[model samples]
Target: MEKPNLFSIATKELSQDAFITWLLQWADDKYKKENEHLCLLGKEFAKSLIKLDKKLNAENIKIAKVTAGRQWKNIDIWAEINDDYALIIEDKTQTGQHDEQLKRYKKIAENYYKGERKVICIYIKTGNECNSSLQYIQDNGWYIFSRSNFLAALKAFNTKNNIVEDFTSYLDNIEKETNSYQSKDKLKTWLAAQGFYLWLEKQVTDWNEWNYVANPSGGFLGFWYYFTACKKTKGAEIYIQLENRFDSGIDLCIKIGADWERTTEHLYKVYGILFEEAKKFNIEITKPKRFKAGAYSTVALVKNAFTTTSDEKLDLEKFLTVLTNTENLVAEAALKC
Candidate 1:
């Protein structure tokens, strides 16, 4: 049996925020005598935030104060270093930024400091997200502290503290679960499917957006790109959607966002173009037996979309080629319409 971990049970964002706050608090000089290792680790974390500013040298920089949660503008974590820099961390587990919260948080921090200290905003996501989401964070002026980056910092300390060890172990386990798709012959769990989606997000360069869509039946990881506006319907567009449920196959579909009448019209137009283009690439995409019309409806599908290796493992390269070819097909078809 696996050993019990508090973090594995207290998996909420509040729990993670508390852990980060506790670690950052140890950076103060008062904690050096209590536990030297923790103090050093805390200081290292403080440095990680400070190092984001090219003008600021984190070496020999001393932390003045550390605050977390409700104490300071409801920010997840805040650290004041040497009267010159204020680091604000907006921590997230599986959620993405909404309601322009990143911009709002940065503005709040800057206004609070009022030009006295350089406010550095960091967005830390410990869970999996698509590259497009990460890019959006960067575009909004927040430095992204990813899962791999956090793991690298924690592993570097090699501390014996039980709290640190447990947290590290928990995070490492999550990382392994998300990466298990590489070795497994099938996508057997939600984490494995998420891993596969993340991998595809990284490999497919032409996709405009990718995210997890929640539904009553079950959530699906969806990728959308090659948007072609419908010439007939206003505020309607047709795009290629790759929906993966880890059921040993991917649904390569052409979807539209409009009412049923316009959706069917746009879907068929784009579907016909893709059908012709796919043949040239030796790809097989067939019309679904039945088409449903709704806000987002699938008009066409590519059956058995993924190619497999001899041992029945996923063929990453061949599958990627198919996806890229599909994108090309959509792009070419968009021009004609």
Candidate 2:
């Protein structure tokens, strides 16, 4: 008999009540057989991470690792993307890891930072234990993922299976299915079987991270090519972080004009260049319409709300001139330095 996935079990035809009992029995058998003290978990996880990359990217999004899988004490998969950056992924099967995992990675990533301001760490865990190990994994200020997450993972899986095919059909299915009582009962049973009932209530997700090194040009680079070439659709998100250190960053808003339309030869560039000459430069770069909490509105907000090119407005030009001049000076100084 073949192993049943969450969907097959949920949507499988069987009595609502007895099906739940059968599902748990199956999960217990499979969980015990495979997870036997989390055996072969590392290999399983490495395989899944490769799949996750393929599911996340919708376009020609690139992904790779700077390093290959070596049985390091605290790390697992190390890869890269776009030939421009790297992602260090560590997978654990059981509850979690010891406290010093991320601290240990310092020795590994210290070598890979070739003045490249881009990198990420991924953790694809079997269980949903989010504590210090994972927290510290992220606190080091690296991009991390424990798992693809439940909803996100499901959506990706469905897309791969060609279940609903498009967004409209997906939404329609959601509306039709979630409203009925039988569906809810089947779902509850499925959750209970997998030991995911309480976990679902708590909203658990999979993310996990760490670091290691061997040869950037050898196996590491080979794995990088493996991930980048096969998996094109990858999901990514970027955000800033501050932790009572009084560190400040600048804010700049942008509009996706040509990038979204995929037209024109010019690539719109947005990068931060801090000017030591002009302070009070800690502004968060964002799109024109998005107003962060506690931020005062600019004239651009009131009048040119719909327009993306708020750069053309008057007051914005003045304020931006000061910022650009500062950035230009900083760039010049850096070049000189």
Candidate 3:
């Protein structure tokens, strides 16, 4: 019912390395209840324990343990606090394995008869020793704490209630800030690399003026040129003059559809919508600007460099159809759009 000696915790001399070894052994010997100590723990606690240790070092809090009320079958330790709270300590040694640990803790706490069970698992990982590892563990998600973090918790505040509030704030801040971050389009690039050809085939067929966004990782859009048609005139061999520039860039010049060219204003307004539409379908767009050769550059024949077309087909038709399909069966049939 009273606060214990703070001096002992302040002077608690235990090497982290030694403590980690002992703690692992303790989980098996003192902490284990059954045949295998199969409810494994380690690197996780090393991580969370670090936080607790730091908190202890700072004289903010101290680790307190009670082997539960000794009545429950599954639970081994009831460490944390009581009346009005209890932190359920589990070691999330592996990425997502700690799910069961917390589940079991909740199960024990149901019979705990000691107010609300504010549970947090301490995951000490000797293998990983940085925020990234902690983040990796978190991405897999188990409400686990790293050793350093657990120690940090101890150093900041001593009371169980204080620890709960502090830890809650810590996590809340992390979520508010860290949850939005992504891995620089790692998942997106992976998908693109996998089924890129199929995507290109699909994208090229769509007219209706759409955008095909390129993946930053795409080193020269390979396998995308087959489905694309180059700009052409009424009757001459209309070479792609600039292959690989627009949707229809090829290593060899070919008669492809014209590039979609729009005025700057129309381009911006339509671009956002088309861009969104393309993204929705995972279509990749080219950089710089793609225009019908007439708008920016002359549609000069690659071989002759003199012949020109009266009316060339632009590349936007398929995209427009996809965005707003008008039941053009021939374009659909030929391109397999």
Candidate 4:
């Protein structure tokens, strides 16, 4: 059975301004007397907010007013406590920090804020990790609150309650998605620590004639190695396929970016170049179903190199030789194109 999103909102907006608005409004005390059960939700949320900064005393805190999408240059969510402290929250979903936006926003928030209130900035996201550096966000006195931490606080608040349970289900979904990508990141880090990628890096440096640089964005799985050509050509990669518990194979493939104009003729031309080059090394080309006359810019398997051995361990040396030879062939083909 499909799970229900309580807000009936798009998953993309689940962590965006909509969720922030709903959270802050719930945290506001004026809405408390209206529904005590729902008011508990606000109390729990305020607990998380107060715990965010140790310097702020929760005893002096009073749940006051909440605003969103306006005031202070359109911050995602803003909450005031006891008329003396202001909390500014900025939520980022499926996006990275842009143009020192956090720093700029903090400055704007402080400058635009009125009265003798102490302003605090919070950067909230579904995940704690990002490709960009978040040092500036931390350095500028902004607290980081990931969805994991928020969900933990909510779960601890109350579990059997119906309203909290429904909200938790929604948060669980987002946390599950975040875990999926985080697992891939762990695999990528593990693969980089292994000998294969480091050995390939050495090969690229030693065999400078190939005009190819090693890149690790082969796929989410850690079984592939990617190489980018110097002449603005689509990259080549090799996939490690395990079979029969004792036999492993290397699949030579090409990756075409979406910007590359893919055509059947161009596919065939590149396939022919790779085919002839593999034949020179006594490596037979494998025409998989995916390589059959079709327009695909993502991946095209060109050949396979498989071997049988009784040992349980992988043949790193032999596989490395095969991969380097295949990459050289791909480099030559790219130069011709």
Order the candidates by lDDT, highest first — what do you get? Answer: 1, 4, 3, 2
Give stretches of model 2 more than 4 Å off: 1-74, 130-133, 142-144, 147-154, 157-337
lDDT for model 2? 0.31
Per-candidate TM-scores read 0.88, 0.30, 0.24, 0.51
- Model 3 off-target regions past 4 Å? 1-77, 80-87, 98-101, 116-143, 147-337
- What TM-score quantifies how close candidate 2 is to the native fold? 0.30
TM-score of 3: 0.24
Write candidate 2's Cα lDDT for 169-266 as tens digits.
Answer: 33333333333212212322212212222222232222311121133322110000001110111221111110110112112222112112222211
lDDT of model 1 at position 326: 71
Per-candidate clashes, comma-separated = 0, 30, 60, 0
lDDT per residue as tens, model 4, 164-236: 6665777676555434321212212322222233233454443211111223523321223344442544543
Q: Select the stronger candidate by TM-score from 1 and 2.
A: 1
The models' CA-based lDDT, in order, is: 0.76, 0.31, 0.32, 0.53
Per-residue lDDT tens digits of candidate 1, residues 1-337? 8899999999999899888888888887788889988888887887776776667767667665554343477677887766677888988988888888889899999999999988999888888887888888889889888788778778777679999988898889889989877644446566767788787766655556777789875877777877767554556666788777655445788776754354566567667876787787667888876665678877668656666778777778877777777766655654554
Candidate 3 local lDDT, 56-123, one digit each (tens): 33233322222222113444334433222243433332133334554555656656644454444344
lDDT of 2 at 110: 53
- Better candidate by TM-score, 3 or 4: 4
